[model samples]
Target: MNIKKENDKEDNENVEVFDEILDKSFIESYDPSIIVENQVTTETNYGDFQHLGCYIICVLIIYEFLLLLLMGNITFLIFGAAVPNVIGCIGENKNYTFTENGCIKLYEIQKNESCIPIIENQFESIQSEYNLYCKEAENVKQTSAFLQMFAMMIGATFGGQLSDNFGRVKTIKYSLFFIIICCFLSSYATTIEVFNIYRFLGSIFVGTKSSVLHVLLLEYLPKQHRVWVSTIFSFSPNYIIFSFMAYYTKNWRDLMFVISFIGLIGLILINFVKEPVRWLIQKGKLSKARQSMIFIEKWSGKLTDNMEKKIFDYIEEESFKQEESQRRKKSYTFKHLFVTWKLTSYSLFFGYSALVGCFINYALIFNLEKVSGSIFMNTAYLGLIRWFFNISVGILDYYVKWFGRKTCHTLAMVTIILTLSIVLLNIYFPLQQQYIVRFATLFAISMCSQIFIANSVAQTELFPTSIRNIAVSFQAVFARLGSIVAPFLFGFQSYSLTLPYLIMVTMSIVDLTTIWILIPETKGDKLKDHLPNKDEWIFGKKNRELKLLKKVELEKKYGSRCN
Candidate 1:
């Protein structure tokens, strides 16, 4: 028994020596930045649960739904269905002798002393008020939409710079305030010119608020949960809400007033949300970051004292690094996006994808007016389809590990390409079944919407914290360009029904090629918080490989505990 006990003791001592040597080896090659990043990753994983995550998500949903009311389903529903000539008649030769189908002869016309031409409408609209049925005024509708998109493009770029330089929270609040003001003014405008001007201005604020909100939400959430939260939040319920509101509200002015009121509600709700700790740390606001961490700890019941200590240790270390670099700290702008070849490649591919996606999606929407159906029903169908696909994609992203970001993206592109091809077939074969045509178009749009959210989460994952907001906003600029061009593309249908779809297919092919060639798979990867170093910037491989290896070593040493 004594001999056996001695042998067991010797075995235990040898095991300890091995562990000590392994730890020493790890310590010698330790990178403080990597350790800090891992600590943050762990903390965020824990932070994904409890009251804090729920609260933030609720606030974001409200913000998105409210903004969508102003610019999404509601705006499209009102404008797309507002034509006076759809159900009524514009009289011929300054006489009210025209029937719903055609102009009647003088013998069939009702007797009248003064035969002045009158325009009749099913509902009050800009088309009725401004006499937009004439060829001279037809372009005005397209011009209004184009101006709004152009303004949004400008706003997105401006918001990115403002958010990075100032702060996300500040930018959101200010943008909301301005949006409310613009909506209110739009509701009371006496002239079409004034109404359009207010709408253009309001769209700018909407774009700003949207871009900053995305960055803020992503920064607050964990990597795994971000896909779902970002995707699901984008699933706007406003389409259903707008359908009911438009059914009851006949006047466009009343609709505008209601949208403005919703904007006010959003402004009030934004105060309950907090700034992201990651953003605060990146900006070197350690005190604020510490306070935010304490707030998180208070709400998160699962967090332990040890976890809290490790988190603060990371903050302390980061503070030292920030102080060391404070004197040489430079502010990032849109121009920095082109400074490196890697960045330039990412920017070009992503921007083109955004542009193409917006063009195809909105072009389909604008073409809805030509589809033979109730406009309200078409809008409702699209809204429901988008909601269904958004949830489905979100669930897939959250649950399916193998069906990753790039896979989801590629699948969406394929779906779009195939559906657009079907649209082309319908154009050539001339489908007699209108419902079949509607379904194909809606399906294509649903897939486009899926791509919209997927690209958002994927791009956010790609860019670092320093320029993340601006990079996203730059994509928004391209998306707005697509939106701006959609009206003009739809105009080509007047010349050739197949022209627009052909262009869209060509663009989708280009986008798919860019995706495989330029974009990297970013799933199961750590979120980079800083720009690449000199070596990594030039070669684009060294730092990432080194950091990844260190992560593996740490994970192995910790075993399941790290997971």
Candidate 2:
């Protein structure tokens, strides 16, 4: 009995020694308090109740889809659709009867300055001609177009910040309600100034919706599907709603009103979306978080204390694994974002944003006038093509993992450059038999541009969760700025298309170079693990060590009482 007791005491001492070493190493490497808090509150592996809420939220998102459709297409049509038609209307002879074919003829005449206005002595006739001319002037329409683009950018930037500070759900709901108010006001605006104000206000909500919806959808989804869901949320609704918009309204004001009504629907539906569990935890609403988790459990039909315990255990295990890997790493800081290696990633992201914004926005508009038979025909054709492209891309998204993001991006960039080159060459050297070629080139440009969808995945994976929203929004802000500028620069003069295309090509080359130099392979990587090598220690390494130490401490503190 005396010998056995001595052996047992020896074993206990050895275990204590082993634990002490682990504890010290863990504390030196990571912060234990942080790991334990994260493990208890991170809210991963949700039960079915959460998913049910997600489904309800998705239905609300459909209303968002409707609003997004209205906002994007309304701007597209105002600038691309109305400006050209108004220009054609202004140059038409006063006595010339309006006919479908005549509209095309009048447009061509206006393009060449062949149509001259007839002078009349009568005051009424002069007044009538002046009114029509004012209505159709390209300069006036162009200003409106510029305002719409500017509004989109300004709104998005401001909206993104607001959404971050307020709850995502609140930002979405309020912005949507504001959108409805703007739409109604827009419908009643008699002067150009009032119309612009309404449009600008509506644009703010439009911009807010973009980031807010993305964050909400991504947070609501399981981590595995978050990227995919974000992409779908970004692309699919624009295609569907815009296609419907094209089919519905002829008057610009009527279109604006229709869009506002859609925004109201989205606002009403906002009540259905539950605040994400992660957001609740972040806000330190533990009871609400528990209710959300239990709701998910019941809905999934997997409710049990063991299941909750297992989730807790899994989190601890992951925490320890991270700590073990990070034991030897150094810490990272915000300054690391500007260092030599990290700057490459920023440059690559900026280039990608610039290229997509300029090429897609301008190329599509230029192609409509250059390729299709008439302005109306071009609008119809481009809308249809865009619809097809979006649908095809949605399908392609499922298989994008197979091609890999870098390869897919490179392929798309190459395709866009080639197609754009052909269009630019046609512009330089007019061809008698090249109409078909021009049309084919435009279609290719639209198809190739679908690759920008990859931006959501790439940008999201490039930064840690702490800076992900800010980083993504920063890149997006630049992209929106690019979108705002491309139109005024490219579509301003009849001959300005060459300058824009040349600039786009140059941007694409830069994008490709940046992609090659930076942009590490990120396929199948987790969001938390996306930090660059330097950041791996601070955000990555220390996190792991802290977690392991906490786990050991928990066992030490709770083992005797529980056993």
Indicate which candidate wins on lDDT. Answer: 1
Error of 1 at 502 (Å): 0.7
Candidate 2 per-residue lDDT over residues 409-494, each given as its tens digit: 67667766776777778777866777655565556545443555556566555655434555545555666666665545545345
Q: Give per-residue lDDT, candidate 1, residue 157.
A: 77
Could you give candidate 1's per-residue lDDT for residues 1-563 as a string of tens digits?
99999999976765565466456584465554543333533433223322335455565666574556445422543443355543332344443445453213322332533333355554566666666653333466677778777888888878888988788888988988898898889878888888889888888887787678777877777777777766666634566667666656666777777777777787887777677777788888888887777777665544678867866787777888789779759998887777568888998888998998888887777656455566667767877887887777778877888877778778888888898898799877987885887788878877777777778777887888889998999998998889888868966867897888899889988888888888888876667777765323434444444444555566677797867
> How many angstroms is residue 229 displaced in model 2 relative to the true structure, after the best TM-score fit?
4.6
Tell me the alpha-carbon RMSD of every candidate: 11.5, 11.4
TM-score against native, each model: 0.80, 0.69
lDDT of residue 214 for candidate 1 = 72
lDDT of each: 0.71, 0.55
Residue range with the least summed lDDT across 10 consecutive positions in model 2: 120-129
